[model samples]
Target: MNCYQKEDLIKMVEDAKQLTQKGKVADYIPALGEADPSTLAVAIYSGERECIYAGNIDEVFTLQSISKVLTLALALMDRGADYVFQRVGMEPTGDPFNSISKLESSVPSKPLNPMINAGALAVTDMLVGNTIEDKLERLLNFIRQLTGNDRITYNPVVAQSEFETADLNRSLCYFMRQHGIVESNVEQLINLYTKHCAIEMNCNDLAKLGFVIGNEGRDPNSDQNIIPLEIARIVKTFMVTCGMYNASGEFAIKVGIPAKSGVSGGILGSVPHGVGIGIYGPALDDKGNSIGGLRLLELIAKQSNLSIF
Candidate 1:
């Protein structure tokens, strides 16, 4: 019933694209810095296996922090909620995603939520693999299933860039290791974390991934569930509360969809049985979310009445 065409979304895309100038590309990660700040793209994947896209739809980008949500879902499936929640809290933090101030201040010393770097690292630590290569492959295979794309994999250049500049994340890992929230070699954990974050895909692939998440872990074309229903619910709940880094509260008020954003200017939105949206805009707000992508979602939510609230 919800078959959107490219013509239907072009206006919204163009309008949102103008905001690209208001934001800058994330430059701290050297490879991420190489992106063109003006590029903006989107794809909407419906339950019917239909897709509508606009802008630079072929551009491939790293998942960046967006991988956190997928990894969180995978972690929850591998380890039950009881086990996952014990390591990371459900509360959202007012601090930036990379900030470790809250970890030091909290009585029990755990990351506030899995959306943050510290918590993501802890969740990645829970992935069951005998070796680092196996762990990365497990995650990659899971992602390929989610997107229905057999060729999906990480960008080694981006992964290595992140690994080389992961001092802050390394520090967080060391601190968590001391607190027992993360029990593993810090170097190996960081390597795995970077690899997952560097997973690359275009807007179509991202939309497919989001569709699976929003569709309650069932693939659009499959009778079998890929992710458990309960696990999907928990992941969407976390997206609503903590997905947009420190800007989640404002984003929820405006868009009202469960969404997760990455520093690469990619946003994965699930409208809860409605549609899954993938957006890419290399220009990012101060909080590291895509400026054009956020505006585009706001427009789509308003026009389509897609808010869960």
Candidate 2:
């Protein structure tokens, strides 16, 4: 079982919930903007049959950028490290997640990392499928197995909203295609990318997924290796260095755990060889992170000493 009590978790959520007033929901995607910014929740998964949560723990949100970590893992398993790294670099960039300046200047024009739009598109292109539908089904099935929730699926409304306003991502795709970093049709890739990003789940489900990664790819319930050990290490390492979208370094020093946050105000964190943390608070900071979620994580990590560093 987890170390913290239910009351302690609730208190931390209450403390962080106040920050919801100071931030805004992401309106760029209209569906995402509809979230109640005041919503806040936290869940901790500590091994088999043990989960604890506080606040609006049932609030479900889209995965957004958090899906990048999963795709990177699947891509590594499908294509292997050498082939995948050859298409994307390992370094972290200080620019925004959607910024394209680095792609233009970098040698060979590959994205600096898979966490960014350019690189994620490249990784999606390598997803080993006959068509977009085939690729998306594979991704959804993988996610369902990871969470042990067969009902997990993408939010069509959010997917449609993101696809309509994804011109910036479209541009990123075209640029990569010119450099041979991606070979799929631009629209198809965007459709698949948006759909995967729109996969929705509550913090509880997310925390379980995090547990698999931190537990060396083993399923806490079934004791099956869900992800390869080397691949899990690579994913968590990327989460530490690039998962927070250029705010990673600051988050590393403050929270010191591998985490990936979404504009929907969901943060997936895993303390290597320890517990998995999932938090959701739709009120976002200027950098698109969940402001209240970040605060709660800081408190939990400090109180529980969950940092890997």
C-alpha lDDT of residue 214 in model 1: 92
TM-score of 1: 0.98
Error of 1 at 194 (Å): 0.4
Q: Which consecutive 10 residues in model 2 have the weakest lDDT in total?
A: 1-10
Clash totals, every prediction = 0, 0
Which regions in candidate 2 have their CA more than 4 angstroms from the true location? 1-4
Which regions of candidate 1 deviate over 4 angstroms? 1-5
Clashing pairs in 2: none
Encode model 1's per-residue lDDT on 10-126: one tens digit a residue: 988999999999999989999999999999999999866657888988999999999999889988988899999999999999889999999999979999999999999999999
Model 1 pairs whose backbones collide:
none
